[model samples]
Target: MPAGKSQYRKGEYPTFEDYSIYAQRVVLNGEFVQHSHDFDEIVLILSGTGEHLVGQRVYSLKRGDVFVIKGETRHGFRGAENLELVNVMYDPRILLSGEGDLRAVAGFAYLFLVQPAIAQQEEYPYAVFLDEDATETASTLCGFLIRQLEDCAGQYQVAVQYGFKTLAAYLANHYRTREDLSEKLGIFTRAVQYLQYNAARPIKLQEVAEAAAVSQRHLERVFFEVCGLSPMAYLLELRLRHASLLLRGTSKTVAEIAGECGFEDPSYFARVFKRKYGAPPNQCRNAKAL
Candidate 1:
């Protein structure tokens, strides 16, 4: 590993060689500019609600939500009033290729080495969500690591190694991959992910179908079966949701917010926003002000 600075400075400066494990407890009353990191990150939400823009998908965050952010992916956090969380950053090599007894295990090799390699090779910024119990266990281990790093206690490095491995193993057990999914299901899943990642763009059915390696008609069938919404319908829902968040979080005018969220027509955006939230966009902004 080498000491290198990522262009990202919204959080702490991330350097892989300085520490294999970097943990931070962050509180954001505002927003984090869209940025990317040079290393993988695990985020455990401790409190508050917010929206996480990872790639093109916007995930609504709440307590007990856990997310894995692969390296070099663009992400942002916004509209959180009292957002707090523990973010753990580590070099993938620490667990993937690092010399360790865990490497000998078949499951470990499959989860850490083989699966991640495939994901990287395929260029998918996939994320994993932990269950409630797993999230609690992860949070506890992450807390210990954060405290030890801050305290500089004796033998903290040993603790870091132990805790990091334990957390990795825990996640490996609960982790699910899309690699084993059925073709139709896999295509549908990717289509959903595509919408999440590109909902704010001028997307079309043909593009999404191509991304899934399927025809538009076939994709529509699977999407309706799995998500009960057409791709365009889902994209509209995502755009409207983003518009609502902007209305509450920033003072941007309705037109500006609409454009930013991918709605070309301000009047159409207003109509949809009003229908979804039961209030007009300007009224929503005003209500938030009070």
Candidate 2:
């Protein structure tokens, strides 16, 4: 079968070489094929209700319900009528660095790495029920990310990264901890945090969803409902913006700059840069020199 039409087989959801982090809004009308990916995912119900099958267990889902799917976990959605949600996909390491190790960051450890581990041992999929306050805060952050992704000018990468960090900090400070996972932060907040901390590194959507303790569909819905762009669009905007700055402010060669900006191909980076900025990389450098 063609990609995305039926269930995704293992390794079927290809991770892009140059980019990581992806979110998209999904409108489910009927049953979807069972599929699995190589990355983590988070799903949040925006409207309507459905049954989500993750591995062997099934969970009844409705508005404000969030589900997290580990990489390579077989899952699908069923019994739906106008079921809408956002999917946030990313890698897990996005939130951890030298000082940001998972063990060091209590929130990161609890939601992303720890919860899934426990859920796996217990043979249950991880999920949560977001309260109204948490829901609104999450919706606002998702909206902010979408806006920055769609703006298409200025230092959007910086903006998106900042937004992600703000979202993360908000969740870390406000959301419940592992001991009291009963009251949790909004799914969108966790996702934004993951994006903010890990955007500069090589990461993906599955990781982001896992970190936020949600399903990919849930992440995408808030991003679209609030900002009107997909997660990848936002990530691309970040890479190009950084590349443009390097072109204007540094003497680094285009190839070197592309690698620094997380692009595997310098030529492709140049094409994307020109498309977004209306000028070639050399022009930006030359203009700065003059």
Off by over 4 Å in 2: 1-19, 97-105, 118-126, 152-155, 165-290
The estimated TM-scores of all candidates read 0.50, 0.50
- Winner by lDDT: 1
C-alpha root-mean-square deviation, each candidate: 16.1, 15.1
Per-model CA lDDT versus the true structure:
0.66, 0.58
Q: State candidate 1's TM-score.
A: 0.50
Error of 1 at 77 (Å): 0.6
Residues 1-290, candidate 1: write the lDDT tens digits: 21223344323543233446788888866677666665567777878888876766676777766566666576678787688888878765466323354443434433443233233332443444566777778788888778766765444666677767777777666655433555765676566656655665689899999987899999888868755778788778767755765675467899998998888899999898877878888888742331
lDDT of 2 by residue, 1-290 (tens): 21244333223323222123345567887787667664566666778877877666677876766555665577787887788887656543334322333323435534554344334333333455466677567657766755655563444555655554554444444444223333232454455556645656677877877886777787677656534656567667657755765675468898888897788887898798888877768778843332
For each predicted model, how many residue pairs clash, with residues at least 3 apart or on different chains? Answer: 4, 31
